[model samples]
Target: MDLIDRYIYAVTRRLPTEQRSDIEKELRGLIEDMLAASADLATKSASGPASDQTNATIRVLKDLGHPALLAARYRGSSQHLIGPEIYFLYTMVMKIVLLATGGGLLIAMIVSLITGAGGNPFTIILETLGSLISGLAAAFGWVTLVFAAIERFSPEKIKLDRDDIFDPLDLPEIPAKKDRIHPSDPIASMIFMLIAMVVASFVPRFVGIFWLDDPASNFIPLFNSAVFMMYLPFILATMAITLTREIGKLVSGRWTLGLALLSLGVEIPSLILTIVMMSNKDLFNDAIFTQIFAWLHQSDPFYFDLPMKILVGRIVIGLGVFGFVVEAVKTFVFWIKRAD
Candidate 1:
């Protein structure tokens, strides 16, 4: 293939299939201009009507830059989508959307089945499957259209002005924010943990339900199951907190106090768990102390004895107190300065 055709193919192939033909046409037009320039140059030169097709093409291509570089220019010199990242993000977003929809639908169906709606088993299953498929197809169609439209409308074709010209545009850059959840985060997490602990501890004793005509017998999955189910709330809360922390740093800017408060909402469970852990020793085996005594006794199990655990715990608690005092003093000083 000719140099122009090869260059066009290399670049337009990187674009969406729908856009490739139109892009190829534009690229060919550009090549034609370059070829014309070279031909005119040859005619005007003092070499006496000399013309070499290979030399002329090489000269034209060389002036246009490397094939890849020339192709990249069409994606807008200032802002453009890289070949790989475009497809990757598209797929990633599509996956998240699909998962969200599918999960919601599945949860709903399962809950409905568990609640015992009067319906034929086979018919219900078939209906559910058909509905799911239909919903997924409809969602896929809309989602695919949205992605395709975004790809089509990408501002990759805007001609960039040469650096020699005066420019006035200035973009504001938002700094990445840190997500340091306030004390509130720990509170919510503690609450979730406690709820999980309580439900795990007591809820099973009260759970009695009949699945079939058989006597209502055998409640609570297992002790391990109870523990896991109880902790589900805390696990979910922690994940939410972590997500907010990351997202606060990203799309929303920084981890502001507002986000910290939101994290606290989740941390409530954690605080409750911590408190419960501190007050209750019977809940734990001999090896496991209530959360408080455990923290107080925390030491290298292999390296330290009870004495060292107490010693280290006391020192750590002292340090925590000292830190609080220092912060309080600093705040007082700031207030004094403001008053003066």
Candidate 2:
């Protein structure tokens, strides 16, 4: 039955991939046996085989309890920092945090390379790697600590009828078959935005280019630091708005009118800021441009000029605006279709 298959999927999904097939086999066998026993008893009593056994399957699943809890039982009673009741949520949060940390570190590395943060390329790379590892460890520890505190101090238990803790009506609606948002989409966006914010605001010096000719003077900062710093607040605000929208999407598990509106709100200001930044003459470092052009001239006998740089900046900004508009339109369309 479809319900049976769904039930099996729900349970097996919580398990490790390697264990899922074996556990599924065992679970299906046990369920079949239980159903057969029930059918046999009914048959003897009624002088015929049981006509409808779907209800029997439902009863079996209910008795087995929540799929997450059932999966935990199969995993055995090991002492855990977080209990089964909130284990799924804990894991999800950990995954998001870890992904964000990794992405942030990657951005930082790119920025460092471009900005020539350190005289030595190897040192910059090593420093970035170290930061990435430490950041991941810190994120993991913080998440575990938070979940552990919840497990220990929260008086509310995740009981089946825990109405006081949560309202049934507040639960997220199940998406229509064709309209479901893939979990990875919001997750990846959140990570990317988190990285962008960290690199842009806190580690702006890392946003430069590197050269191999002169080891000590190989890096060039992309932006005039003073000008970039002045715009940091606006940049950060846009990133924060987008980050919040992504988080909301992750929690709600789908796009909606509210999310689309929120996205538009973020995009409008972001687009404006993009225009302002691109138009400002102080945004680009003249020395860096000169150095890069000098290197280019030496290699190809072609000159890089102001108009070329302006054109490139405009192209980049145009692409960003185009992307924002496309996403906004898609979100609005999805929301409308879902509503209808």
Candidate 3:
């Protein structure tokens, strides 16, 4: 019964929400009928009904094949630019690119506002919007073009080769249920890293504050743009490594020592960069702070000078370090335990 329930869940989960209830009900009824028929046949032969029913259920599920394949069959074929073989990969790539582009543009816009790139807040916002739209369009077009080319010329490249791919005996052992990673975890991490990289590399200026009264001229940039740009290559390299590791996890569906090591590879460099950036005294725009304090001092004569900019930078850097260490240690421990 548990197996049957799990099978039903697996099949229906891939379906649209509106169709799931009906499909689940139908599957349950069909399975029950099959089991009943098998039970009756076994009873006629003086065999146990419960054992026969279990065997019948297993046979029925095996004949039905993978749940994903069954779900696809139920959905029926529809025209698509890419075939099912490569469709999931195509969508994943598109999602990453779009998110990165949008995130980069948003960061750029914020930086522009703080740096007064166009000398006016309105102009900065307009430029940011324009960049975001254009960047998304370009990314979409490029990804579609690449996938379309693959679909057109080399469809077989993405196909699972039955003849020469691997030895059946050498296939990976099935992971323990407890150790198996959920498919969504790596996907979410990939998206998050892509966005973070875009923000760090492309929009460092946006990490600032603005005075509501004079939005155009009273913006304060947190980090020194020139200094941050110097570390762009390292940031990008770390992002690339993280992306590759995440994609591997997506394909493999579990964590391993290799992945844990790669994760540390990403974290170490990132941690170093965070320390370097935070240590630079020039990283905080002191002029902006001075200007803000000067404006506020007029309204509140007793207003004391507070090093909010430095305090905020330290807090952010500290949090980043903490998160990176926790993840790295956790991954390393999991891998070690698995090895043991």
Query: Candidate 3's residue-wise lDDT over 145-189, tens digit each?
Result: 766766655524443432456567966678778667786887788
Candidate lDDT values, in order: 0.48, 0.73, 0.72
lDDT of 2 by residue, 166-189 (tens): 677966678675455577877788
In candidate 3 the C-alpha lDDT for residue 177 amounts to 81
**Which RMSD values do the candidates have, in order?**
17.8, 16.5, 17.9
For candidate 3, the 10 contiguous residues with the lowest summed lDDT are 155-164
Q: What clash pairs does model 3 have?
A: 110-206, 111-205, 111-206
Q: Find the 10 residues in a row with the least total lDDT in model 1.
A: 216-225
TM-score of 3: 0.53
TM-score of each: 0.33, 0.53, 0.53
- Model 3: runs farther than 4 Å from truth? 1-87, 103-169, 201-204, 214-217, 288-320
Error of 3 at 246 (Å): 2.4
Two-way TM-score contest, 1 vs 3, winner:
3
